[model samples]
Target: MTTVATSSPVSGARRQAAEGTLGGAPLGPAERAARGKAARARAPRRTHAEYEPAPNRADPIDVIDRQSRSRLPELVPLRYQRMTESPFRFYRGAAAIMAADLAGTPTSGIDVQLCGDAHLLNFRLLGSPERRLVFDINDFDETLPGPWEWDVKRFATSLAIAARANGFGPSQRREIVATAVSAYRTWMHRFATMTNLDVWYAHVDVDEVASRLADVLGGRGSRRLSRATSRARSRDRLRAFTKLTEVVGGERRFASDPPLLIPIDELHTGRERELLMGWLGSIVGRYSDTLSTDRRWLLAQYRLVDFARKVVGVGSVGTRCWVALLLGRDDGDPLLLQIKEAGTSVLADHLPGSEYGNQGERVVAGQRLIQASSDIFLGWQRVEGLDGQRRDFYVRQLQDWKGIADTERMNADDLTLFGRLCAATLARAHARSGDRIAIAAYLGASATFDQAVARFAEAYADQNEADHAALVEAVRTGRVSANEP
Candidate 1:
């Protein structure tokens, strides 16, 4: 595998600021606030409530089919099947569809390192490098610089859809959605008043958050939170090692699981397998070069034992994903790493392309920029696949102390509180990369923007349902194929 060149799209002035060498004096708080106020005049906050589909809107199925063309043919059916499970499921996999819709929405001309697919599920519990559990945005697949409103709108819409799935009434759904937007608005304003270093250091500690919410959660919610945290802590590297690997002929290797976890040895034979393993080994070596000096030394201690092409997530099912098993010292010491394919950002069509030439680099850059903490092994590399095509891929631990919300079991009260937490986390992420003061200024002290976004969330949830029905009809009429597991 050959190495790919890296480059950024940021201009000299912006790059200087990013590198801690401001080209000139930065804008004062008052000037930044004025700029935000001017943007409000250009795109009134009330206008954000509107969400009528364009007369010339493209067919949603066509959009799905277009994305499928670049994915593995056999697994495309599986992706459709997952999406067909429910409207919320469809929304999870329809980032590209939403990116197009968000392009026509109102914005405050504010750009940030967006968590392109900032749905409610994407905000979750993660283990920081310091071994502390923190609530933060986890997915960076569709990340790019774009309007801040796009992320807010996608997140709010997800709450609306999820609330609907939980059998919430219209008033309940409205309150849930509004809670999230209000949290984002209020937190952004709070960040605006702090020093840049203080804002940068801000993060929500899971333990502290749970303790504070004890009274609000009462009996059932508190128990649920306790269970989730316990489950997350148990999902360490050793746990994944035991679950995914087994000894065969006195050798540790990945177990055979068709279409999901097919071992590399199973896919090729004899000399071909030898060559494939050597190629993958080289790719791993190249990826290590992207890490810092100390991390590179740490990674060098582990020897690659085996690898498998594994399927993962809703939209990522058809993309090439591999789970590499490495042994550090003995059979008990293992490190599981997931190497996932990175494609063009969904927002690329509607906004400026990333500065980074390699898509994998783009993902890594965005993650490092916004996440309060990141995986030590995180890195990216470009590799030539067996198909003779080069693809970009990012690597990270397969499982850390990761926990996702159980939205299915949540009540209206649970959802409202959970949505607020997600919104606050998202705001912290945005403040790390965007103009917090300007954004807070545009939102103002009123609930106008919050109420407007809640309205948009409901309307867009309606649009999402229609789009989901279109996909279901397509599958029924043989326009699309769906494979049930």
Candidate 2:
């Protein structure tokens, strides 16, 4: 309901403060940052070292159960299975669990468009519009405006958990956490000095990342990065077309793979498929309106040929996700769009409701606001389910040169570099949505905040391991059934 004049430095800084507070209303970015820096005396940076869970903390399994009630029942076991893969994997799927815990952590009251699930694996390589490979936050499923430290803490904890799973020594894991926090803090400071446009335009190019790593790691790391970058470049629409579809009766259709990838025609009876296709067709029309005029025109060229259900991600396995296969010009020219169900973000329970009534619109809007370059075809619509209940869904290119880090294969040096890269990328994302000057000043030039967060990360990783163990125990005792595959 409140709006700030972004054009004026002093008014913008004043507006950055919480509503009903006139504390430093006449200041500029620098002064606001200085005020935030002075705030350390009251909410000391060292306070982040504490990581005790609340005495009344909700049971992790109970929280998981609550979320499961909204997802597809049949695919629930798959979500459990992926989560049971390792402590790191469980940590990846436990954002809701972390959200519950984070509600009780020390917060600076500075809000930002948080990645909400800012784990290390979430930061990866993707192709920018110029076809240049860049590294940025690749998932915004749980994005919302919330305290900045929550994102930082979640990221740091993930680094710690991942390092432990990778068999790193205690000191090595601590170093990774330290490196990550230092990178986030240092980058925020850099962003604080930059003009608005400069911050907006900044991105972490993978080639530059590789070059920087090359100086520190010599040929091996650089070669590994080069391979990853090359692999990402190759995973465009053509690659998806070749791998996910096949010609059937003179028409290209999605190949069926049971329990993971199922063509809609195969999953439902003929009459049911007919009814579903009609709804899907109408949904596409609605979703198209969410795009820009040029993009909608570009999408209008592609004729929908077929669609299939898809199981994706450890945390997202139980959600309704479908891939629509479209033919643009001919059999060789194709575009695959993923229509994924969107629900309330984990942060929504703690923060204000989204301005958009549709959850799909929330995801689409948050992605556009935070991502450096979003999918051109990204859009959303509301569709009625088989049960006759309407659900929100967002659509985007299924695989537009997206790549994820193989955290399982990373060594200590590789992991630390990864931590720094992810941390820096997160800082850039926060700078885009929050008061970077204040965040930077709160972080300060010294290593106090970094050190405190490193300690917190180490402690929270222990809690995550224990929570993961509880899930494993539930599976073992037949309290929760799961498939290992």
**Candidate of highest TM-score:** 1
Instruction: Encode model 2's per-residue lDDT on 87-131: one tens digit a residue.
Output: 888988899999978887787777778889999888888877788
TM-score of each: 0.96, 0.94
lDDT tens readout by residue for model 1, 1-485: 22333344344544432322334656778877777788899889999999999888889999989999999998999999999999999999999999999999988877878899999899888888899988899999999888899999999999999999999999889988988899999999998888889888999898998899899989888889889988898888989888888898999999888888899988998999998888788778899888877888889999999989999989788998889999998988899999999999999999987788889989998898888989999999898887799999999999999999989989888899999999988998888887887888999999999999999999999999999999999999999999975
- How good is model 2 by TM-score? 0.94
Q: Where in model 1 is the C-alpha error above 4 Å?
A: 1-23
Q: Can you list the residue pairs that collide in candidate 1?
A: 9-355
Off by over 4 Å in 2: 1-26
Weakest ten-residue segment in model 2 by summed lDDT:
1-10
Evaluate residue 82 in candidate 2 and report its C-alpha lDDT on the 0 to 100 scale: 86
